[model samples]
Target: MAISNVLMFGMVDFSGLLDKFGIDWHLLLIQSLNFVLVAFLLYRFGFRSVARVMDERREKIELGLKYADDMKREKAAFESSRAQRAESARREAEGIVKSAKDGAKAILEQGKMELQQQSAGMILNAEKEIARRRKKILGDAKAEIGTLVVEVAKSVLASQMTDRDRNNYAAMAEKMLP
Candidate 1:
């Protein structure tokens, strides 16, 4: 029974209810027109300007975000380039040091060669000087021995021969001794 009554109430005519409530159709129509006019004015003057301002703010924010991203990428690139330059410099330094070491080694080897050559030349000069000295000593000794033999022959013949014989013997001795 309650459900039947609720359904019957829902079917009641709305025009009879409006009349009972003292609602006028002309007033309702005028109020509806007023609401529509007010909504259109607010949307045209107030809402449109506010929307424009919001759109401008949104664009600014997007541009700022894009600029920040670009800056971040640039910073990363700069850091990478700096690291590469540092690595290149380190390698160049290593190459320079290696070159210097090689140069030093070459110079050292050249010095050793020169020293060896100088030592060999000195030894050869010393040998030549020793040979010259030995020859000089031998010549002096032979001259000394020849002089002693001539003196001994003169002394031995002086005791056993006459003056002329001794003179001839001395002359022969002198020639034979030489």
Candidate 2:
């Protein structure tokens, strides 16, 4: 009977409590609806679009970073290969020089001034030819490497760039190239 009396008498009544705090139910309902509408509008019209744009920019930046890393790997590989080729060329050039000197010594053993002079001329001509071939090889390798670098840059830029980025990178690459 005590529980029933308490429940029946107004145990949950807020009327007097709300009145003491100057809270009006009608105004509270209106403000709650207003808050919901404003939140929905902000999310729909402002935050959603901004979030999408941020996501797009984030993706582009990530792709650019990945392309830069690939470029570093490719450049390292190119450098290693170029070094190997240069070392090989140097060793070959040294061997040719050594062989020419040996032949010149053999011809000098004949003890004729004319043969010695002719052998000296032959040795000098061989040295000149060796230098010419080495220079040509180095020039060809450099031209090939430069072409490969430009092609790689073009491919990377095509994949990673906006038009503005493409133009900027093209300008930069041109500046880097002779």
TM-score to true structure, per model = 0.55, 0.52
Best by TM-score: 1
Model 1 scores a C-alpha lDDT of: 0.82
lDDT of candidate 1 over 67-87, digit per residue (tens): 999999999999999999999
State the weakest 10-residue window (summed lDDT) of model 1. 169-178
Q: Name the regions of candidate 1 deviating beyond 4 angstroms.
A: 1-13, 20-22, 126-178
lDDT of each: 0.82, 0.81
Per-residue lDDT tens digits for candidate 2, residues 1-178, read: 9988777566445556677788988999999999999999999999999999999999999999999999999999999999999999999999999999988887777657777788999999999999999888767866665566556776865566566665565567546655
